[model samples]
Target chain A: MQYLFFLLAAISVITALVVVAAKSPINSVIALVLCFLSIAGHYILLNAQFLAMVHVIVYTGAILVLMLFVIMLLNMNTIVEVRKPVITRILAVVTGGLLFLVLLAATKQGLSVDVPTGFDPGVGLVKRIGMSLFQDFLLPFEVSSVLFLSAMVGAMMLAKKDGTENVNLPPSSEPDLRQAGPNDSAA
Target chain B: MENVMTAIRVVPLEHYLILSFLLFSIGMVGALVRRNIIIVIMCLELMLNSVNLLLVAFSAYHSDPGGQVMVFFIMLVAAAEVTVGLSILVLMKRNTDGVDMNILNRLKW
Candidate 1:
């Protein structure tokens, strides 16, 4: 069990680094998919079978594929990203390292809490999570559906061509222009 | 069931925390340094995944379903966020002819 955890952890860390360091966007996306798959492995090792499956499906299946589609559509796969200045890259790495250090120090004392007694291995099962979602988190669950609807509409509105009109205006201001243009035309 | 119990006990929770923290930092640095907008978004997804892993680890350790439920909502929101973000990316590419973040310095077009 320990070996599995270490193996998954190593895979996740390495693939995540590759996701960051790869020069081409396609390579990064591919590495990210592998990283996410390893995370799913971690979930399974932790006995969250439902989460493992969901992670695999939602992340690798949906999000990564969507990213790949966009990359392919834009023909961005062949474009090697222009590197930032060396100093800026170094500064960014330094900032990230500092952030990690702060987080580690903050959690150093808090992470040693005793494991709660009466560990129920079944708590991670789909049935319990489903009940909790439908009962206790019902409002949030329904609200998330509303959120998804709005996001879908917003994405469509943002991505669709607006013809030649309002080509220069941001999306947020374009609606106001549309609202005002009819009045001007009528006058 | 016994196997599951043994598995959870085999590794300390601290290791999970360290692993996720490392992943999060890596994502953060990627988002910061990457010039391409799509790779930046991908790094953001990486950060979110690290958080999900931590939440699930805690949920499993504490024997609580709440954290896992939270993870579900997070995934939903993440999906929505990615949809909108990528659409914006496509729009940016269409209008600007390039997806480089440096070109987006001017707020007004």
Candidate 2:
């Protein structure tokens, strides 16, 4: 059982690294899906079966498809090769390493505290979670629904195409692409 | 089932913490170094997942339903964030014809 835990954790970490470092955006998204799957495995091992299913459905099913559609629509499949100064790249790597070391150190000290023995396994069950969600966290749950509604509206407003008529467009906000000066003729 | 729980408990929680930290750091590095905004967004997702892993681990170890419930809330917010973020990216792509982050430096001054 411990071996299974280690194996799943290793797969998740590797796939997560691939998701971050993959050159192609499409490849990165695919790697992210695999990483999420491994995470679901972890959830199952933790006995949160319902959360595991939700993780797979919400992440791998809905979110990944949305990302892929956006990528396809935007035609951003190819890696955009931008040259960054060597110093900044080095700095980023150093900072990331430093953060890892700091976090690892803190976590080592944190694990020294003894965990209470004999946990109730039923707490992670779907029925328990549902009851707690409605009873203890009912207000926050309803508030989250409101948050979702607002996000939906905001997304729609932001994504809507600008009006075709120039009359409605605020003056000087839109750059004039039609103006080609004498400098263009010189070329 | 009891045997499985005992086996899981035998493994120190510190290992899970270290793994999550490493994953989160990798995501941070990608977010910092990558110039493509879409890849940056994906890295952000990676970071969120790493946190989710930690939450689930704690949930199991502590035997608290609250942590798992929080994971659901986190997923909700992550989904909403991705929706808005991708919409903004789409808008940028429509206007700029590319997704390169450096090209966005026009507003930096």
Candidate 3:
């Protein structure tokens, strides 16, 4: 189990680095997909087989594919010169480094973790999750459906183009819009 | 509980927490440094992934199923977040023909 976990962790870390480093957006997204897969592998090693599958299905399968499709649809392969000012970039790096260092310091010894040995890890199947969600979390469950519907409608509204803006074009006395009548009304 | 800590293996839990912390930091950096709206949204998802890892780890340590329920709720929210986030990104893309988030500053500046 240790070996399997280590292998998966190593894979996940390397792919995550690749996701950050790759210059192309498409490559970065692909690397991120790989990172998610390795994380799913860790889920399996942790004995959450159902979560492992759902993580892959929901995140890697659905979310990432949506990302990839968006990239392709946008055709954003062309160069987009990064616009961040140098000082801001430096500050951002420093802040990220500082935050990470603080987290590492606080969690350095991993805090005293205790789990009762020999306890059943419980059933983590989809059916079990569904039952709990529908039974105990029923109110929140129904609310989430309404939330999702609103999000979809909001997204559509954001993406849609509104028409019917009347434009008189200044009555176009310019040559391009001038009359094309013949005769000494010259050709 | 006291005796459990005595026999508990320290390595695995530390490792998982450290990895989650690292991923969360990376996501934070991505959010801070990237000027692309879509990429920023993706980074947010990464941050959420790190949170999910923390929840799962806690659930394992406590022998409780409630954290898993929270994880499911987060996924619900995440799915909604991404759908709206991406739609807005697409809208931004159409408006500007590119996704430089700095374009938003024009409204103010």
How is the predicted docking of candidate 1 categorized under the CAPRI scheme?
medium
Instruction: Score each candidate by Cα lDDT.
Output: 0.90, 0.83, 0.74
Highest TM-score scorer: 1
Candidate 1 lDDT over A101-155, as tens digits, reads 9999999987676787788888878899899989999999999999999999999
Error of 2 at A78 (Å): 4.2
Misplaced by over 4 Å in model 1 are A165-187
Tens-place lDDT per residue, model 2, B40-72, is 888888889889888988887887888888989
The order of the candidates by lDDT, greatest first, is 1, 2, 3
- Which of candidates 1 and 2 reaches a greater TM-score? 1
Q: Residue B14 in candidate 3 has what lDDT?
A: 76
DockQ of 1: 0.68
Cα error of candidate 3 at position A135, Å: 2.7
For model 1, what is the error of residue B85's alpha carbon versus the real structure, in angstroms, after optimal superposition? 0.5
What residue pairs are clashing in model 3?
A: none
Report model 3's interface C-alpha RMSD after superposition on the true interface residues. 4.1
Give per-residue lDDT, candidate 2, residue A128: 94
Q: Model 3, clash count?
A: 0
**Most accurate candidate by DockQ:** 1
| lDDT, model 2, position A24 | 84
